[model samples]
Target: MNLKPLKGQHHVSAITANAQKNYEFYTNTLGMRLVKKTVNQDDTSMYHLFYADERGNPGTDLTFFEIPNAGRTYRGTDSITCTFLRVPTDDSLLYWKKRLEDHGVSHEDIRKGGTRMVLFFEDFEGQLLALISDQGNGGVKGGSPWARSPVPQEHGIIGLGPVMLTVSDLGPTEEMLTEVMGFRKKGPYRLEVNGENTVHVYETGEGGNGAEIHIIERPDLAQQRPGRGSVHHVAFRVEDEEELRRWIQKLKEQRIASSGFVERYYFKSLYFREPNGILFELATDGPGFEGDEPFEHLGEKLALPPYFEGQREQIEARIKPLNTKSP
Candidate 1:
């Protein structure tokens, strides 16, 4: 594919059981801004919520589809086991540790991986997450501050960090990430999970917060069962629709089936599965969260696509009501 490397992660989509709880945990606890309030396009009965930094920037988004009846997620091979959010410094990491503890959110002690320090934790629904402190590694940069957030501006999360994928075998997946996709090998490190297993790190873009992917070679685990608390897919950033179309052509040449170009309202996207069966997406960064609403009123009310406008009453009636206002 001879294209420019991806400009870090665009967003990571996951599933959650309750809309209101998901709203509170991300907005109040983690201090992220609820940037978009909408329903799932395919299933209007469910809500699709987006939370991010102050501006709802491309790489800062972490979204969820609320499905109360969806069962717990089973972690295994060919799945994104953990999603990381980048904070600026070691002091910020300490601030988060204290914050999580005060909020009764359980988290592990800060652990070292190469030059980075990682603090692992999970959301209210058991969605695996980590807060990575890069300690001035040029890889992580730029974050907008949410002035209204309880979390002070100095320690607010920057954006999406490394996504950890567990694969049955590392060879094919690693090849796909490096050769087919334009990621460069960053190095490897040991993780203390199910004993000491080595994790190979690969990165794209400028190699910081939203640019890293960690692949853990777990050949013995079972295939993951998709449900609540599991990652639906991970998206990488491209410049624009032209670049996105180029990716579609490149994937076609590689004999990989893709969803062509999907108009996602906020961003255009192309979805495909990697060799290890994990869903991957290439998305453009334009027509962002501010496309429909003004920045001051973002996520203040339910926002629907033009197609869903006709059925707004029906959709709203089916989905649960949410309150994202600060306390």
Candidate 2:
């Protein structure tokens, strides 16, 4: 069946033990805009905070689900190990290194990752993250940084870059990504990771930093024990609900057991796990964060979807109050 390939990286969702600290790091320290403050649809007892570029664009979002007191993540195979953010130029990497130092954020000296320069770092909860310099890179374009971001526009993060996935076996995962999901192999790069030396690169739709997935084969390690700072899933972009429905149909044909169609209010989604058991989601790009709240006051208040509006008071009472208002 002929189908349109996924556009690129939509967003990366991870778990956080504390919403306040998560907000502080992604917004104040990293300088991303807090675009949405809502609860996890399935579990309204916790907060699902979204941070992105100026408009909460599809390729820019980095979200967290607050699971109060969640245990620490023990790194292993079969995990979405590291999430990369994009900086405009090679010089921006230097800017971020000093910025990370000033903020007391643990980071490594700039090093080369494939064709680009990357600076590795950890969040407050030890979420493995890196800033990749998009110097001379092209493909799916990055988003506009928030105008009021503390980090200067030239040095601020523009959008998400490549996501690192570590799995026990690479064959099934690679086949699922290529033949099933339409990702094209962009060749492999050598990186010594957990004793699993080579990392293969895959790219979909207008491939580039924003649309690549780097997979590492590490049969030696066990599955990760996920908790705080663990990535829950990574989503790829679909143009609209129509496109998302097509993707759902495609998954059904492949006999992949998926969540089918999930209405997220802001976007429609279809979730399924690949061979390695890593959750993957295909989500629509629109009916975005602005539907309930205006741009200027995006995440200031607890904005619930219409269906969840009735239980607003109860949801509010259960989840701790988080002040997401911009400074």
Candidate 3:
């Protein structure tokens, strides 16, 4: 059967408190580019900021809705967990270690993840995040924001490497990831090559979503409360709107609860919750980050989707300024 899996890890969007700080931490500190600065279709009071590679490609993008008035989210056993990006492993993270230090960014020293080096940290919103790699996935070039990671442009962030998630029920979510999403199961979870520390692992395509979307199965953990550190939602990609619509119907037929298609400007999104309670979104691939501004000055302007075409001024006025600030 021709699998209709996602194109790759398109992007992950989360809710944040300060759009500027979020932009700064992602770009200035992490070396990701602020590819897009748009307004949320549902609530214009917030800004939808996108961070991605050089060209603002699909699978390499990460987005956020800066909700200033929003409260803090909790991060722990019941949370959606951290998102990990892959960078060249040969001394690349060494630069990152000091980069975090020079910027005064708080982070734990390098940690071990199977055969990879996993450095975990948190954003201003307290959202758990990490950078992990076993030498990056070949040639995926990324826009490096810092001057330190001078290992050359051939190796930058090769898109999301892995995403760790905790859940009460892994059955339905597993079906969606492998069957519906088309990821190949690597095998039973393995954290050690010799079978010391084992953990679930799955793979698909190349480096785009590279070995990502990890689910931590712990039914005994209590439910999480949403505040400052929880992940809002994770988005998988479909080639186009037609593919998206097709899945919308397929999801319904599969008996998996789903949401109506939402036109999110750059791309349309369909939201739903896995049985374990983590929100999952299937978003389209097109209208990439360049839809609003040129790659050179992508985040400089106040970009708004067609939904907010006429209300741009009012919406812009309502939203407070942050690093992703605009006119």
Q: Residue 106 error for model 3, in Å?
A: 2.4
How many residue pairs clash in model 3?
A: 11
| Model 1 stretches astray by more than 4 angstroms | none
TM-score of each: 0.97, 0.98, 0.86
Per-residue lDDT over 1-327 for candidate 2, one digit per residue giving the tens place of the 0 to 100 score: 778888999999999999998999999999999999999999999999999999899999999999998999999999999999999999999999999999999988898888889999999999999999999998999999999989999998999999999999999999999999999998788864445378899999999999999998989898999999999999999999988888889889989899999999999999999999999999999989999999988888988999999999899999888977674
What digit string (tens of lDDT, one per residue) describes model 1 on residues 1-327? 568889888999999989898999998899998989998887889989998888889889999998889998877888999999988789999999999999999799998865689899989988889998857677646568588888998898878988999999899998999889989997788898545889899988788656889989988899999888899999999999999999999999999899998988888999999999999999999889887899888898999988779998888888778887863
In model 2, which runs have C-alpha deviations exceeding 4 angstroms?
Answer: 193-196
Clashes of each: 1, 0, 11
Instruction: Summarize candidate 3's per-residue lDDT along 131-160 as a digit string, tens digits.
Output: 775563442233343223222444456566
**lDDT winner, 2 or 3:** 2
Model 3 vs. true fold: TM: 0.86
**Model 3 CA deviation exceeding 4 Å by range:** 1-3, 134-156, 188-198, 206-211, 323-327
Cα error, candidate 2, residue 211 (Å): 0.5
Any residue pairs clashing in model 1, and if so which?
139-208
**Ranking of all predicted structures according to lDDT, beginning with the best and ending with the worst:** 2, 1, 3
